[model samples]
Target chain A: MRLAILGIGPVCALGSGIQSLRTGLQGKVRPNIEEKIIPTSHGEKMLPVYQPVAEGLDRFIPKRALRRVDPFTQIALLSTYLAIEDAGIAFNDKSRVGVVFGSGYGPTRTTFKFLDNIIDDGDIGASPTHFANSVHNAPASQVSIFLGLTGPCSTITCFEHTLSNVLVTAWDWLNQDVVDYVLVGLGDEYCDVLGFAAVGMNAGRTKDMQPMNFNACTFLPGEGHITFLIAKDKSHQEGYAKISEIRMRRDLEEVKASISNDPVIINASGNLQQGKSFLKVQQKQLKSYSNLYGGFPTSSAFDLAVGCVSMKDRKIYPVPESQKKEVKLENSIICLEFCREDEFNIYKLE
Target chain B: MSLELDLKKLIIEELKIEDVEPEDIGDEDALFGEGLGLDSLDAVELVVILKKHYKIDLEDMEKARAAFASIKALAAYIRENSEVQ
Candidate 1:
């Protein structure tokens, strides 16, 4: 809590970098949902997936340099470059900055590719490159190498709670004086295996996500990465918002009882009958960006990234299209990410 | 395809080597460090490629290095061991 967010970077289906998010909030961009063939238990299945355009990545890492790198690593690397470039800090002593990445599923595409090789060709045919990139911390390792960060580097995975843990870890590193700034981020790429599983698992699904409709699983698999460059010191000229507090609770009654008319973003994208308690926060004029990025387990990170954009741009992006409520330009925003009725995290930004 | 040309294609595809074509690589050019600039990872990938394509097992690391010196050397090694020729 109380960490200053110097810069925020987001790469999603809409596109890469913060300007893409600004255009997305302005409703000027749409993602090209790519279809791929995946063999399921029944037969071969073609499913739609949200893939990032990654247009700005070439400016940071040339395409030839990234040919050997997996897509998952490419996504994370782009996010890091965007955050650093947005922060506008020319870091001479990179050892003072650390890296921490969270993920719902680490390198699913590369891991599956490795397994595919093992299945098609014997173990002898397995490519060593795929095996090396399949690990959980590979992205973080690659980030440290590219950024030349001698500070502590690590990765964490806990499904929906991954973002909360990542932020807390960043704050802890700053508090402990282990580093001056922390490059904290979360990402999960959508592959054919996950796409097939998502279609099979959710019977009440749709092509678009309705995050406000807590009664339905109108969800689709989305892919991308989001990063925040955080520092304990706010010496920089501008910052997104200060993380005032992070509270984990089992109920929203207190939050609703103390809630104001100010805008609050509800991370309510999930299956029906579960996470319905998030509907209790309707007392506040709400905003949700799940439609722009689609639905994923670590969507809370995406929500926070949207919150940062809203904080910086002084505008609340519309969801549900009707836009019944208008949030005052300047005010504190609270982000509520609900995993269940009893398990959720509340982030206060001011 | 000829064995030498096939090995060249395999090197480019399996190693994810970009911006280089089969014709660009000389028949007797070095495959690692000074020539194509492939390192140990590429060497390991080349091993898997050889084993998968020709069923030729270069268990001896030195012999693998010798064969990997050039696409022509790799093709000759395959011809000496593999029955396709």
Candidate 2:
């Protein structure tokens, strides 16, 4: 089903909402982490961290509700609230609304706390509340609970492709008429021990590991939540962009063939002809925006945000690539592709 | 045991900095952009960590920013505001 983006909200190092984020993207500054906690011996040094801009939580969150949720959940709920508000949808009738959350790592603090208690004071020390909040689906569940959503609720954790995975899932939900509106998001919170441990375990396996452990230029642990409301009808508030299409492919050649047929190719490689000859037939603009956003899992969320803003501004901010100065946008034609392990590829054309 | 030393240890523990001990973090060192090396994100995360550890809530950014400047500063802030007598 075709879905229109009604509203968008994000908390990142770039700042909050669309405008600050737009400026951040255009500037292409690597987010600084500077988190104090470093290894006592042999571990990664933290660098640029993704922090949420402290807006008045009381403005959107109830005092009683905030008492029970973790900081990550609070960020997710706030962003979700902003999406609903931007969509101009009344929260009273939520039976028609669905929620989907994407996370590379779910609520690390909650999980960490639970583990700490279990190790320190035995299983009896584990708090039931913390245990409940530690699940992968807790973020999405919290959204439903806070918004009173009775519709379908789901969560997707596909490592780096989390946002894209959720996007595809949300697109399906909208197309099948499962729900008239859907709130989709991705949230990741930093856990110092977990972050270091992940890199330590995966160090030899992955090429793009966190840098030197202390610089934000590398993978410093970050916490951020971005929410979008998708509906059949266009949103009342100014929408940043809309989903053109979302497709997942198990084969790269199949994706290449499909991309060759698309009208726009926003390849991460900066080579427009990187797809296929069929796509190469046209004099389509080839550009990259990686330098702007500094490649992350939910970077697509930023890309989608950029696409939305580009639609509004009528200009595509070009990444520093080759002889190409910039990619101009006469109309809103954007294609997003995410590939993992060369075995799976997901393409979304909007 | 000085409360400031304990606070530094807690910061190191909560932030999961395995390399440093309470002695590494000076009582008057800057937490961000210098001495202790924390950013705005760490400041926010520290809010929850402090609440859990010391039972103190630092909500305002200005206050959080100031308290986070150094282990000593954070300890002083905690001592002044903590309800436990």
Candidate 3:
């Protein structure tokens, strides 16, 4: 069974919704990176991080529902609601739908806040509300509760490849006839701790975040959420792109053998070492998307979203003007992502 | 804020009791089950609040249940057992 993307809701550093993302990809808007100071052992350090533009989520979700959820969970619910609305699908029976969400760092701020309460004022001072929302699956649970979906609900937290795993798992559920529709996506939030870690780990090499540049040592930390409503290929005619195939590889040879020299969108927003390795992939044509969304573990989700838009619009959002080249748009688009030192995911979108 | 008013505000804010104001919560109203409709999670949070703010720890399950029976009962328990001045 083939799975098709019926709707996409992307809340990223570029902007919220497809139009904002498309405009950002067209080089009409630059990424909004904010400089913030984070506390360190000796003093304070400043770092550049990509913060998502607020979309006034209160307008979509009721105040009662919003009070109990954290920022990450709020983003997930809003994105999912937007996707379902975008698909124009009505829920007659909520049990026929499922939710699968992924996150590189799940509810980091909430977890830390709970820990702070415990450490600062003992266990009795810890907020039970914060503790309830600190789990990795909190976003998924919130989505299911807010949307009243009773089908299969799960969450994956595998750092960079979380989105890939969520997509693959959702595909399996759809193929098995477990659910009629599945909302799969990723939601990660930016925290000062993450910023401090990113900067401290790559002190010398880190620079302003830019995509596809193998020579840059620094990547800007980013956080956002993107959700998609996916269903069987023949089930819906309004799909953006049909997911032809998905493959994961741990060995370089396996990735090389599976990859064809077709025009491909490369996710080159990883560390310098991974960027160097991605540079070796011989492709007839190549493009990078990290420039628009900034560098993050789940940044590939943005790339895939852009790929779907490009496919449907019959236009390719080019790389930076300095590295711009003629890209021949085709019916099929290949997305190559190197998520980790030993892990890579290849997606065939048509 | 007075102890009762403080408790009401804390309950409303911590438990995320929506569409309800601090003055709306009756002193003798049930905290769980029928009145405010708080669940077991809210009960646990109430315990934390009592201990953290009032320095009144109800270690015994029976006494804790009795104290949590109503907003008035919780306030009374805090008034009698509070270690904080």
> What digit string (tens of lDDT, one per residue) describes model 2 on residues A142-217?
8888767899999998876687678878877877888888899877777766556534533222222232122222
Candidate 3 lDDT by residue in tens digits, A1-350: 67799998888777777777888877777777788787778677777777777585777777876777888888787778777777888878789898998888888889998898798668777777898889989988988887788999999988767877999999999888889899997878888778788767663244465556676665777888889999889854896888888887655677677666555787776468767777676554767877677666777888888889888888776775444643556678888788666467888888
Evaluating just chain A, the predictions reach TM-scores of 0.92, 0.77, 0.93
Worst 10 residues of 1 chain A by lDDT: A320-329
Window of ten residues with lowest summed lDDT in model 2 chain A:
A206-215
List the candidate numbers ranked by lDDT, top first: 1, 3, 2
Candidate 2 wrongly placed segments (more than 4 Å): A28-32, A40-46, A198-221, A233-238, A258-296, A320-327, A332-337, A343-346, B1-85
Tens-place lDDT digits, model 2, residues B1-85: 7787677776775555545677777778787886766656556557766666666756687888778777767777888998742
Per-residue lDDT for A279-341 in model 1, tens only? Answer: 656654666777778677777788887788788778777764445543445787888777665
Assess every candidate by TM-score: 0.92, 0.65, 0.85
True lDDT of residue A313, candidate 1 = 73
Off by over 4 Å in 3: A30-32, A54-56, A203-207, A250-261, A282-284, A320-328, B1-12, B17-40, B53-56, B60-85
Chain B alone, candidate 3, TM-score of 0.90
Q: Which residues of candidate 1, in runs, are more than 4 Å off?
A: A42-46, A203-205, A233-236, A273-275, A282-284, A323-327, B82-85
Clashing residue pairs found in predicted model 3:
A205-A217, A206-A218, A207-A218
Q: Pick the DockQ winner.
A: 1
